[model samples]
Structure formats: C-alpha cells, structure tokens
Target: MPLPYSEKVMEHFRQPRNVGRIEDADAKSIEGSPACGDMVAVYLKVDRESLRIDDIKFESYGCASNIATGSIITELAKGKTLEEAKHITWKQASEALGGLPPIKTHCSILAVDGLRAAIENYEERHGLIREHKPTTIEVIRKRLKRVMNPMVGLDLVRTKVVKDIEIADGVVRVAIDLPADHQFAANIREEISEKIQPLWDVQKIVVEFTE
Candidate 1:
C-alpha cells in the first residue's frame, strides 16, 4: 500500500535532516514502542542561556513512517527554545508529513514525545523546572512494588513492568512489557489504575506485550 504521507514527508524520509549524531549533546533520550517494535533515540544540544535547541539528531529503527516522524520532529525542534519546542504537538508533526494514517499517528506522537523527553532530561540535569510529569507507568510500578505480596509470588500472576515512561500535555504514558497470552491483563490494568489514583493523575496507560 502507498503510505499515507505528504510529499514533504517522503522527501524528508529519503533525505532526512540532521541525520548524524551530535558530537557533544546537552540532552539525549531513547524511546521505543514495544507494541509496535519501533525504537528511536534523539540527541540534542541546547543553548542554555537562550533555551534554544542548537543541534538535533536521531537514530531510528522502524518503518518508513517512523523514520519520517523522527526526521520532521528533529527539524522542527532545532533552533527553537525549550518552551517553543514543547509547544510542538503531534498534530503539527503529523501535519508536516501531509498526514499519517490513523494507526501511524502514534509513531508521530512518539517522535514528539522523544524530543520532549530529551529536553526534559536536559532541564533536569541543569536544575530547571521539569515541564513533563511522571508517566502512569512509573506511578503504577512504584505503587505495585510498595504493595506487592512477596508471599504470593511475583511469578504466579503475569506482571508487566514499566520499561519507559513519558508525559505530555498533562497525560502520562507508560510502556510496559507483558506476556501476550496473559489471561489477567485486564485485571492487572485495573489494579494498577486503582493503586495510582491517589498519588498521581494518570491520563493514559499503554501496555505493550512482548511476545
């Protein structure tokens, strides 16, 4: 099938912007969608005084749409202030690509998320106020660990741990690794939500089953 991407998106995929690595990156983050088996790592150098992203690069492993998303996000973030970069939304990234298929929308969202995460890591290291919040997965993990019954045996019931967490637009997304045929998946999700309701405001929970 022909990809649902703009001419600009195809062009960027063919000739990606900022394709190489940054020699000295101020901030860097790696993200993967285990559900889709898409992984991307972004490296960035920001001008602290101006909060502007000076250089950006990416290494991606996924389909063409994933590549297009990373390329466009990097181009948009470079030379923009942290505040400005944070404002760059998935909608904008998708729009830049002409448009992505409904299912592929998450790929673009992941790119925007990866960029924001790198920036947040930069700010955290520099003692700047963090713009993103803790993801739902993080909260769930913490809660689970605290209340887990060691006597019940962690192995008896299928469990997924939070492998990666990101927050955007006041919503928390958690990447989890779980067994594909685990019969208790629904109950586990509910348990996680119930546990985290008091401590954090969770917007969404993304569960990724790894075979």
Candidate 2:
C-alpha cells in the first residue's frame, strides 16, 4: 500500500489529535466497520448549559487513513456547538486530510458517522433532543437477548465480553469469542443472522473464535 492518502493524512495519523479517553466525558460513542476492520470510539465533554462541545478525545483501531480521519474529526468537533458539530461532514475531513483515495473514502465517512452518533447519544441522554423511538442497538440487543437466550441457554452474555459489536450504515457486525470448529458454531451464526436480519438489514456477521 503506497499510502492511500496525501501527506496531510499521514501527518495526522503520525501525530493524531485528542488520541485518548476523556476522564469525565459527558457522552461517549463507538462505531466500527467490520468489513474494513476499523473501529473508533469518541468521548466528548459537553457544556450542558451552553450545549457546546467543551472537550473531545478519540481512540481508534484501523489503518492510517482511519486514524487520520478520527484525529481530524476530534479537532473539528472541539469547541463547536452541538448543532455545528452535527454538520461536520466527510468532505470536511477529507479536505483536512488533503483528500483521500477513492477506495478509502469510506474511512472518512466512518469517522464522520461516529462523531454524529456520539453527539446524537449525548443529546438524547441529556434531553437535548427528543425522539419517538429508542436506538437500534438498544432495540436489537433486547430482541437478541429475548430470542437467542433460549438457544444459547445463558441468562445473559456479558456485553463487555463481546469484544466488538458495531452498526454502521444499516450494517451490523459482531465478533464473539467462540470456538471456530465447535460443533455448534455454524448453528449459532445462523441463529443470530436469522434473528437479527429481520430486525435490521444486516450486511455481514463475523464470528471470531477466541479459543
């Protein structure tokens, strides 16, 4: 890979901005694209009174372009009002990176999506915005727990132990620690896909065996 980005992108990747956690973040959001193996978690400290982003931090797992996108997004969001931050787009991130290659455009889009999701979570939790429905993750997790619990014979699987569950652009990706060659692995994958596909237009399901 001869670097799928311009010099600016490399610079940001090498010296990423806000590359850590916010100790007392008001809101945190994580998004991942299993197709591209990219994951980003964004934490924000919002000034509730002003409804502005007071501080921001990001931790990402992926390629250089993705890291650069995350770094640029955090810098762009800091000090901006929630409304302003919502308008931050992939074009702005790509421009900041001096432009990414056509193939890597989704990387920038992913970062933009993650930022928007974090802000949305913040607004919803603080009553800054009202919605008639809960988030898809909440709804799907509930359904999965209800429907799949009987099949798995477990009360609840630790969400943290899941390691990775990401939804983006109508696609959901889950990585679990099950044995690859286990007799029931295929059945489990099928069961999950069958359960969740009806709830969402799941594009992919990746099962990683930890043991």
The prediction achieving the highest lDDT against the true structure is 2
In candidate 1, which residue ranges exceed 4 Å CA deviation?
A: 1-3, 33-35, 130-211
Model 2, span 12-80: residue lDDT tens: 989998999988889887655332356688999999789889999998888888899999999999999
Query: Candidate 2: where is the Cα deviation over 4 Å?
Result: 1-3, 33-36, 131-211
For each candidate, give its TM-score against the true structure.
0.63, 0.63
The candidate 2 region of ten consecutive residues with least summed lDDT is 147-156
Global Cα lDDT for candidate 1? 0.66
lDDT of 1 by residue, 1-211 (tens): 6757678778888988877678689988765433344667789888878988988999787777778999999988889998899889888888888888776755566567678778867876787864545545444455554222222323112343545556565554545455656655554455444444433346554545456
lDDT of 2: 0.71
RMSD of each: 10.3, 10.7
For model 1 the TM-score comes to 0.63
